[model samples]
Target: MRTHRKVLVLFAALASALAGCSSGPNQPDTVAGQFADALNRDDIAAAAALTDDPTRAADSLNGLYDGLGKEVTFEVGSADRNSFTLAATWNLGPDGKNKWSYTTTGTANDTGDGWKVKWEPAAIAPGLDIGPLTYDPVYPKPARILDASGGELMTQQVVTLVNVSQGADTAAVAALIAPLAPGLSAQSLESDLAAAQGKPITAISLRAADIAPVQAALETTRGVTLAPQTRLLANDKSLASPTLSGLDDLWQKSTAAATGWAVRVPIPDGTKRLAGQDAQPTPDIATTLSIDLQHAAEDALTPIAEPAAIVALQPSTGNVLAVAQNAAADAQGPIALTGLYPPGSTFKTVTVSAALQEGSVTPDTVLPCPGVANIEGRRIPNDDNFDLGQVPLHTAFARSCNTTMGGLAVKLPADALTNAATQLGLGIDYVTPGLTTVTGKVPPAATPAQRVESGIGQGQVTASPFGMALVAASLARGSVPAPALVKEQPGVADKTPEPLPPNVDDQVKSMMRETVTGGTATSLRDIPGLLGKTGTAEYIDDKHAHGWFVGVDGDLAFAVFISDAGSSGPAVEAAGRMLRMQR
Candidate 1:
């Protein structure tokens, strides 16, 4: 009986100790863990309920969660009855790049019902009790685009962005905005709006001048919003608008590196910055374009009614000096640099160069230039059937004798012209930065007929105005210089062709000079020491042709093209007007 009583007493004492242990240190640790779990779950109310002052804790927790409304986690370290280490982290930026992590001490008190965390702002952050936290973004200023003379070519400009909700009256929106936005139609706007399905769709972005007439009306319309935005734009709207537009993308990329940010506390007077980084200044982008020459080219092409373009380069360096196109040509896109057209007699430069390299003929070698001739079953004719019979190779080239060139092409190897064009920078691929370009394509002729057509720049022989300008530059420099627009960033060509022989270079230059003095391009003879070639390329039919003139004056080499001009006269005249400005 005594042993049984002792055993019951001992068991009772052990039970009492176990109960006390459950309600003491272990309870505090359990409560701390529950609070951390609640916070990690974003349950501010549940987390506050585990605190001694629930109301105050709820207020601070709500503010902290709302102010930094991003991903957050709380980890509770080993806890005693009094305190525990709380590690908190908030992912405030993309991919946790701006993560804020810190360790704070949390206190727990024994309330009558259970153990609860002691309420204090320091439990969240060391100084979070001061006020609510906010994220302040610091935007870096965009870089300026500079011309060759170190003048600003592109700058930030304010514009209005118009948007329409899906259910808005797209017809009314389109009718009001079509006048300001080119190529926008009511039917297309309605279709796009319906496709967006309640999403806000951008109607148009209008400059100040473009929005002045429609701003009030657009603002009054329902489901419409007009937001002002800053965009990189040309200083002068007329100065290489397409090129500047492309540079805007590059400007955006340059500014995308680092966006500064600050964590602040809002107070009665002004916010106190807790931590932040200052934005880095972006460097200015330099281009190889000459302002004066670009303006000159633009002015020279203004009077032409048809689609016309001009491209000029510095032969010594292959730096693009100017690229200008008239409004008609602009409607067709950046034709001065990318558009391909039959080079016509301008390709005689390549033909003659190829023949010279093949040891087939000299500039003085006699070739027959008939009004019309059938070579390899292909009919070739001189301009207006006016032929010079039994003329020197240089005279035939200057006069652009298609029959002579076609006959010479039929006698050469298949890839001769292609190789020559590559050497002259025509068929070579150039990955130029800040500018998207296609020099041209000269494929190898598989048949004599194709060769005959390719020789005169008709069948498979096509070139951009930029490519022809490069050809002239190569003739002037005795080799093709790598073309580039961005300073210190030369284009990487796929093929590094050797320079032409001095004899071939001199012969081509002499013939081109004769072209200006007495041959087909006599119209430009007034421009002293001008070397050029005239071309009339038939397209679709023999009645209509594109006019071409590639020329060199001093260190400047240029090409002028007039679409559907029916003759090379207009191109020659345009070239003369352009060169007259250089003097």
Candidate 2:
């Protein structure tokens, strides 16, 4: 009976122990683990239900996650009846590969009911704040727009923007900005101030130099606040404005990816650059342009307010040395490389070359230089009705005799001019990157008069400054050199349909030299070894003419075009300036 009683006591004690172990107290770790799973699933309601302050806790987690949130996972480190700690890992996505791990703690207390957890912002991320989280985008310093010589064309600098606030004195803001930046009209500012409907905003932007003289006075002026911002500016605005615009475009394309930096703070004043990096570093843009030459070109055009373009190229390699256009011309777009203008008398170079190649004429072949030559019943007269009389084909070319060129076209086949122009680097398209250009157009003539007009570069033959420069370059190189804007830019120039007679190029160059020496281009006679031709193209109903000069000196070849120029002298003078400015 004693043994049976002892065995029952032992069984009872064992059963009570098992019950005590199985029915453990609600642990903080269990709550914490459940909470972590709820957050991972984005089940805010369930996660908050387990916390002390549901609304406040859920809000904090939401703010911490920002957009699209992330994945959450936790490991219970150590736990007790009153408190427990955990290690949480957050992933920007469900991918565990991208994770940020942090330690968090929670507390649970039983008040005669089920255990409830104490939640805080730190439970999501340590030191997590209650306000909305924002990422400020930071941009790297603008990469330099470099010249061919690796000098800075455009660089980073400080600029001031006068901002206006509607609540401030309206009259004072206009008066302050007027003297500092004369380009910004005071009348327009007053109108803007009166018309403004909202809070403070930028009214006008000015370079630091524009406001330097009156900076102190402007600073004391009321109602207008000066906000200094960092941006790219040309080293000399007068010299590079319009050209810089194109190079600026190329720079923007190169650095587009590098500008996506999102930092912890806003872009501040005098902040030269942002510290945070988002992408590959910006690559400096290297160009075939010399800012020095560009400055000279700009200076040359400053006096002339008409539409004009100058294109300079190195004859040895066909690399573009400089491209500049007056503001009036640039306002119409990049006319220097792409504008279509009649080659006019400059086409005589091509026509004479074709006539010489086909055994129709020779450098010494005497062609009639009548004041007017009838071609298909159309009267063609030389400029100012002056004739070279009976002279060699070369002399007729030197004098830019329209009558002789028109007569020469009458004997040639229609495609002769077209084929010849293509051989001289015209009537073809290009796909060079960062280059906006058109080669030229020389359609085969259909009528006898059409051929005559095309012969003198008038009827349907059109060429850009780019094309004319290439004509001079082909004459200089004896063969057309391939044009290149960027040093390693990939492209190929179209081949001449058929090769020119070997001697034709030599004859062509001699004829060009005659023009500059004893012919129509007397303005360039003083320029030693100056080989060129001049053209006065009558356009716009013959009311005005566009002056053109294409020339070569040493390894440099260039073309100048002036809109509405009464004579070719202006273009000749500009070419002279360019030649003297060459280093």
Candidate 3:
């Protein structure tokens, strides 16, 4: 009986210790329960007040739940008198595929009312994750006029006039008074008269010879009756600047009004003009165009009368300093950096660079220029019966002998030629910030025949004036800088890399120098160190050939492409004018 009592006493002591362990001092669940109750009651202020660090607690809660776009649940996992643990789950988002989990700890705080939950720095589970929100950027509408640097150049604005005439058969009247109208059209005269008057008019059917007496009589009588049952009135001359054409195509894309009457235009000034109202201040746009250079270029190209484009760039940075579109301005397309055209023999610079890099040719490499060479079952000929017999590589290049370049291309692997072309910035998409630009084409396989043509800048190859300018610039700087319109901010270095090997670059520079000294570009002789190449490409169907010249000064490079023009005096003259401006 004594032994049994001792065993019972020991069992009772073990039970008491176990109960004490189960209770523990203060568990995380105790705090979590109070916090959960506060949150469930929809009392955000009360819940915030429960934490000792109320601001941090509010921030933490907002970070977890503010933009959650779904309801969240906080479960009290364990609790004691002074602390608690919580497990939380929330819907990921509208997609509902994503789920989030969080585990947090909290401490009990002695508020005047009772023990409240104070959040401790909690350990979040799975971390915070976010993706694209509702605020993604949308592209804007395209603009009409793009500047040389590919920036938006023009904005739509309104021009208003007081009196615009809806006149009758003015063309007929003008035809009747042919000698009197002289250079003026009947419609234009009627339109001008209607604009002068405040109200619209029908028809003015008198000859220019008949107007003087009628105008004097109208001034005398304020309004006058004329002979043969005619009526006369003095003409008013109020004209509006921002006239709209009422054409759907013109108005739909315009931010300005399109009515024949004056409509409001959103100009730089903060004022608006109503239809038939005059603008408070006239708007004018200053252009980067040099009229003198433009006229000179036009005159120089008059001999060939070809469609052409001349683009000049500052070499250190590729800013388009000037651009000239030839007679066929409408046909030439946009004045973008990457306008496409056959590079012609001007591409020989690339060939020389490739040859030097491959070690297959040197400055002194002897080449036979027989005027024509048969390679890969195709015959390639030089321009206009020109041949440099048994000449050095430099001399052959200066002369732009196709036969010599053809012979060299036959020795190089197709891939090597392609790689070199790629290095020259071919076969890549070029994007102008605010304008459309074309990327010239280069064939993939580049067969021996293709290689030969490409070597001479023909066959399946094309480049723009801007593209060629980049080539000239690369040669000038020994590396290519990223072309930019806007001035770069401070601490930003240009990140573009050099496209060609240094040795190849040196060879090209020497060859180009020879071009200026004695080659096809000898026309530029007056301008010293005017390194350049001249190219004339023949097209089918008796179309006039394309002429090209790309050159570089110390830190200036420019390319001129004259299209559908005969290659002779005009092309050379254009090149001379461009070089003189640089000097």
lDDT of each: 0.84, 0.73, 0.55
Model 1 agreement with the true structure over 388-481: per-residue lDDT tens digits: 9999998999888999999999999999999899889998878877777788999999999999999999998889999999999999999998
Point to the candidate with the largest TM-score.
1
* Model 3 whole-model lDDT (C-alpha atoms): 0.55
Q: Estimated TM-score per prediction? A: 0.79, 0.75, 0.54
lDDT tens digits, residue span 436-500, model 2: 67878999998888998898888788999888998888778877777776666633755544667
Which clashing pairs does model 2 show? none
Q: Is candidate 1 or candidate 3 better by TM-score?
A: 1
Give the per-residue lDDT of model 3 (tens digit) for 1-583.
Answer: 1121111111233234334333442323433455565554444566666666678666655554454532455555544445455665544433443344566655565564555565554432222222111111111232233333433334332221111234434454445434443665765756566676755532334523455444443323311222233111111111100111111122233323211222122345642332232223222222232334434544444454556666655666655445556446425554324467777787887777777888877999888998777888878877766777899999999888889987887677776655665566544444422223343566643577778777777777788776777678777767654454323311122233336776777778889989888887787787877788877766663256777888887777767777766562455577787666544
lDDT rank order: 1, 2, 3
Please report the TM-score between candidate 3 and the true structure.
0.54
As for model 3, its CA RMSD to the true structure in angstroms is: 20.4
Error of 2 at 556 (Å): 0.9
What range of 10 consecutive residues in model 1 has the weakest lDDT sum? 1-10
Best by lDDT: 1
